[model samples]
Every structure is written in structure tokens, then in C-alpha cells.
Target: MFGDVMGMMGKIKETQQKIEETKQRLDTVLIDEQSNDGLLKVTLTANRTIKNVSVDDSLLEDKEQLEDYLVLVLNKAIEKATAVSEAELSAVAKDGMPNIPGLDMFS
Candidate 1:
């Protein structure tokens, strides 16, 4: 069964390569999201860290409204990022991982 052993080895190596590539991709991927009002936008890493946020100058006309809008927009942006990360991870994991999107690929 030497041929079977070699075939298994090759399959293992291919799976290992996909795992490494997905690990690298997930580590630094970021998603950008914008508010429907165009007043705020944010960038979030795949791991759910907010990298940056921007607000339009016009929103500052009302402080309380601006604050409320900021909170809503930030939450939306994070949600968008979470969706993006899940989609991407799903695509990558389709080749190997069968459990869930955020399962530990590197491990």
C-alpha cells in the first residue's frame, strides 16, 4: 500500500498548505463599511478591531443626534465587518474546515 501512503501524504500536504494560506489571509483582512446617510464610515479588521472611523462635517450641527448616529453607525460597521469576515472565512474553509466560520484555522 505504498501508493496509498503517498497519496495520503500528498493530500495532507495540500490541506496543510490551504490552512497556512487561510491563516495568513484572516490575520490582516479588513472590511470597510459606510452609513446610509453618508455621514459616517468605519474600517474594521477581521478580528473585530476598529481600525478607523470618519464622520461628515455636516453631522456636527446637532451634538446629541451626532452622538446617537455615531453609535448606530459604529455598531453597523462592526456588524458589516463580522458578516464580511464570516463570508470570507466560509469561502476559505469550504476547502477544509467543515465546522464553523471562526473555528481556529491556525491550530
Candidate 2:
């Protein structure tokens, strides 16, 4: 019984390490989104940090359109980043969990 407890503790520590590594990897992941017309682009990391925004010089003259473009691109970038983050975390969760009797349904 003590051996089982010790084994579980070791697995928990290993899972914690993997979680930290996943977070670090998320910081390095870059997700980009561009407008359909290619006039605007936004880049973000899986950690949801905006990395860059680019807009066509032609759009600068039209303030209203530029605002729209910026908003649209930013939203797309954030959405994609969120999806990527979810997928990564799900993978980590699956990896970190150990199979146990009658508990597989929870995953």
C-alpha cells in the first residue's frame, strides 16, 4: 500500500513538471490571423499575448475601415490562440492523467 502511494506521488510530480513545460511551450507558440482581403494581420502567442499587428498602408486613409479591419483581425487572432491553447491543455491533461479502474470515463 505504501509503495502504491509513493508511485502515485512520483506520477504527480512528473505531471506537474509536464504542466510547467506545456506553459513554457505555449509562450513560444505563435498564432496568426489575416483579413480575407489580406489588408490586415494579427499575431498572438498561445498564451494570448499579442505579438504584432500589420495593416495595409492604403487603409490608413479610411479611419472607419481601418478600425474595422483592426478589430476583425484582432478577434480572429485571439480566437485562434484560444483554440490552440485549449488543444494544448487538453493534450497535457490526457498525458498527465494515469489510467485507473472505472475512471476512464472522466477523461
**Index of the highest-lDDT prediction:** 2
Give one digit per residue, the lDDT tens place, for model 2 in 41-68: 8888998998888889999999999998
The Cα error of candidate 2 at residue 92, in Å, is 1.5
Q: Write the per-residue lDDT of candidate 1 for residues 1-107, one digit (tens) a residue.
A: 68776775676677678767765675588777777877878887776788888889887788997888778877877787678777765665456533334766634
Any runs in candidate 2 off by more than 4 Å, and if so which? 100-106
lDDT of 1 at 17: 82
Winning candidate number (TM-score) = 2
Pairs clashing within candidate 2: none
The parts of candidate 1 lying over 4 Å away from their true place are 1-23, 97-107
Candidate 1 lDDT trough over 10 residues, lowest sum: 92-101
| Residue 53 lDDT, candidate 1, scale 0-100 | 83
